[model samples]
Target chain A: MNVSRRYFMILVPAAAVAWESVLAGTPEDSPNYKMQDHWWGMLIDTPKCIGCGNCVRACEAENDVPEGFFRTWVERYHVTDENMENPEVISPEGGKHGFPAAKEDEGKYFFVPKMCNHCADSPCTQVCPVGATFVSPDGVVLIDQSYCLGCAYCVQACPYGCRYINPEKHSAEKCTLCYHRITKGLTTACCENCPTGARQLVDLKNPKDPIHAFLKTHSVQVLKPQMATGAKAFYNELDGSVR
Target chain B: MAIFKDTGHLFRFAALFVVGTTSIFVLRAIVTPKSFGQYGHYRGAALKDLADRPVKYAGHQACEVCHTDIVTTKTAGKHAGVNCEACHGPLAKHADDPSNTPAKLDTAVLCVKCHAASAAKPKGFPQVQADDHSGGLACDTCHKPHDPAIAAGGAK
Candidate 1:
């Protein structure tokens, strides 16, 4: 009787603790997912993208992103033959409603999707005074809104113009590569919603990931190789005129 | 003895300062999230918050369950990898109740999203000068949305 009572006492508390953990909701619930085992990146096939703006809309809906601020955006670049270096770029409302029909057929026009590069040596992380912004084990650059100072140093430091101080949260916000989804073994909202398979989520550490083969075969380039931020977002068929 | 007597108040103040600092440290340690430092500098709790946010997208598989015929045809076509939500928009509501039918897509604007001609696209990609391709006719008028090759010979 005494032994049974002791077991019951211990087991009851243990069961309650287990239930509490379940209620708390774990983000990384995939049994096989290990953060260190993967390095997340993206391949943006510029040629494949049609500027449908599905990605932008999906991102806003998924993240509840506020108006006038964008975590990810699309830019329509019009490069004229006469001036290749100076391309006319516009992203009216961050291309959420697609783009206006081409006014002049003479220029070379294309859409470029932009987001956080998640740089290996990210300047944004370096400049953060409180270390609130950091690169996760899976190579995602994330910001802790609770700890962020809202100084905008990281905003200024980012060469890609991805970071913004979220108006509502008053914290430095940018693309997390959808860490929550990626960790849970799902693709990012933007990648999931892209009509064409233009934006692909790549796991660099995984040998089976298609990115390895794609990188080897394709002449891919980062947005600014000169900055040498070790930007993970690779663009395929990037035009020389695109800034 | 004389020096000790004179600095006795200083010793008491030093003791109080150490005790106060220690209490603050203990409180901070207790309040901080357990996994805060596990990844890097950012609070790991934020990840859980983000993951818990309600999913807005219904995903491709959910649509495939009900629309088996469409899925079958689409899988064999050029848009095999494209999710139904890409064009239909978020179908969480539709999936929950069939009564909430998704809106009919405008075929002309939908096709032009990818087929619009541009020098930026690779020469090999299937692009058409929007104005030149079928004039004012919708893309689906000539080509099937499910399977474009069905009407491959010419405009039907």
Candidate 2:
């Protein structure tokens, strides 16, 4: 009886510790989502954007993004004929409340909405020491908050200024391409709210997706091609002045 | 006898330390998730958690169910493919209750959201300088929200 009691004392706590670890490791449930089947991307038609700021607002509401930080934002660029290369760009409050009336009529103005490019050869993923940030099988870059060490390496690596350390979570955060919604056969909040159909969610693997035809026809270019990040956000009618 | 006595305590301490370390490793082995590194470095369970979140936007079909007349008129116009909530805002509340009327949209501001002139826009696409076009008149004065073609012609 004494031997059995001693064994029980030691074994019970060990078993309990093991069980707790198992619970901690429990993953969120996703059923019937095959990662190999989809390669997701976005096509932003710069000409179609009117800069209403609906996409920015929708992204914040959907993601619970904090103020002064942006998962997505709209930049209004005004380029004059005299200085085409030096365009004036501004995004007041991340363009959540829409833009004010243009100040100068001499310049040509257009709005460009920016977000995570979800690069295939992402610099952010490469710099994460813990692999907290990684590209998913469907071409979306995502962060695991649980595993993140709150290091800012990913933030520095992003050339487009997409990432920020989430103030509340203390983790590096950026656009997931609405991973939660897209995996379940729904479009992104930004795409859904865009009035002009300026933003479109594309599935590259799906041969029937209209992006195939659009790519064949339109002169689409990714942001910062010099970075060679394999960025998937295709911009149609991107102005030469846009950085 | 003196050496044996001192060494016995040291052996006991070493055994305890090894046992404690072994137990921790055993626990970790049992608790670690099986599908953690299946795709890349991220936990596979995160995908499921994200998928389970409630959808916010009420899609085009939901609006079409009740507002058939507006849908018919819109379908005949250029903005047919545009979802109703693009202008109406999120309809989760309005969809649940018919009495909750959505706020009226300002035509001047709303129309320019897509129609403002920009050199980056295609040459053929309809665009106007908001201040110059119609001399600061509201867009609705010249074009109807639902059927602009009929409003412009004033016949048929």
Candidate 3:
């Protein structure tokens, strides 16, 4: 058999094309295809939040959040006057409950629940050296424990101050939006537990969800939007004084 | 002599080619081996595929048939939704022997299978070990697993 140079050239390109196809299609072959639909995010209406800390308790009970480390926290803002910069100032202890009586000299008090922002451009994700912290295609930021090296860069770089270095696992961990639960068609424990309906999970891509409609009707903005991380969590009627 | 030499060369080339191809095939098989276990094949099955046939329970209602009251109590309560099979292991043997009492199923140990103890779930609320469950407080004493009601104060 006379092997032609033309045929050899053709064969090489064909093999390369075949390998590329396999690589491109590898993820589709996975069993967990429904993972694509999951864009785990939350919306908080600061105005609606009663600061009852029901969400905090619910999350703790449901998910088993530890004593020192909280999966979700609330910050209380005390704006004295409409213009004055000096407020009462009592952002204490993650505010598992409402602020302790608004520092005795209360004017205007409100609470903001804080958790993993699950930023589109997460600084925590970018800083992770081992590629453990990653944003999924649906926009939920996450940590893959199987791949984590426990570098703690994710813990340090999180602007929202959510990620923590888990001492027991020796790995950086944070609110994964209850990925195991969410993947199973269940809502996040925090969202499920909120009695006041202050917290709402919404698909940003879906126009039909109340979150999108609310964002349109009322002026809603993300915390530290100037940071430009494109954080999915939005606060409705955010207190300008708190910023 | 030339003819013999040519034939010998052809024979060596043929042997090398056969050995090389066989070796490559064997190496590839070893490197990218398929799953061998029976469970491995079913991993990709959809819910409908899994539930196509009634589960093999051997015509025995098992726990429910014997413990109607417990089943009724559990079902009416919070744990009513939880499948009995989730806690109780396969029941074919248990069904066969009514006299053979089941060893006390450790509720704490069983709950841990779903809720792994992690930083997020630190207390491991449902999983009560012997020390954790002692002091007139078995897991069932405080928590009626079948029906975990949100009590007036709170469900502990």
Give the least accurate 10-residue stretch of model 3 chain A, judged by summed lDDT.
Answer: A97-106
Misplaced by over 4 Å in model 3 are A1-33, A89-93, A97-106, B1-156
Per-residue alpha-carbon lDDT of candidate 1 for residues B1-156, written as tens digits (9 for 90 to 100)? 475556878999999999999999999899877777756776876655655555667677778888999987787777777788877777777888889887898888887766676555545557777678779788888887766664444235
- lDDT by residue (tens digit), candidate 1, A132-175: 88887788888887789899999999999999998878888899
All candidates: DockQ? 0.44, 0.33, 0.03
TM-score per candidate: 0.81, 0.77, 0.55
- Tell me how many clashing residue pairs each candidate has: 0, 3, 5
Query: What lDDT tens digits, residue by residue, belong to model 3 across residues A1-243?
Result: 886999999999999999998865544333553545546578987766655455565556544567678778877666678685865544455655444332334366666788888898889889877556677666777766645789888888888888777778777777767654454444565665554467877777665667766877987888788889989898888877655
Off by over 4 Å in 1: A1-32, A81-83, A103-107, B1-5, B96-100, B116-142, B153-156
> For residues A113-166, what per-residue lDDT tens digits would candidate 2 score against the true structure?
999998989999999987678888888998887778888999999999999998
Q: What TM-score does model 1 achieve against the real structure?
A: 0.81
TM-score of chain A of each: 0.86, 0.86, 0.81
Error of model 1, residue A237, in angstroms: 2.7
Candidate 3 clashes between residue pairs 3 or more apart in a chain or in different chains = A64-B120, A64-B121, B77-B147, B78-B147, B79-B146
**TM-score leader:** 1
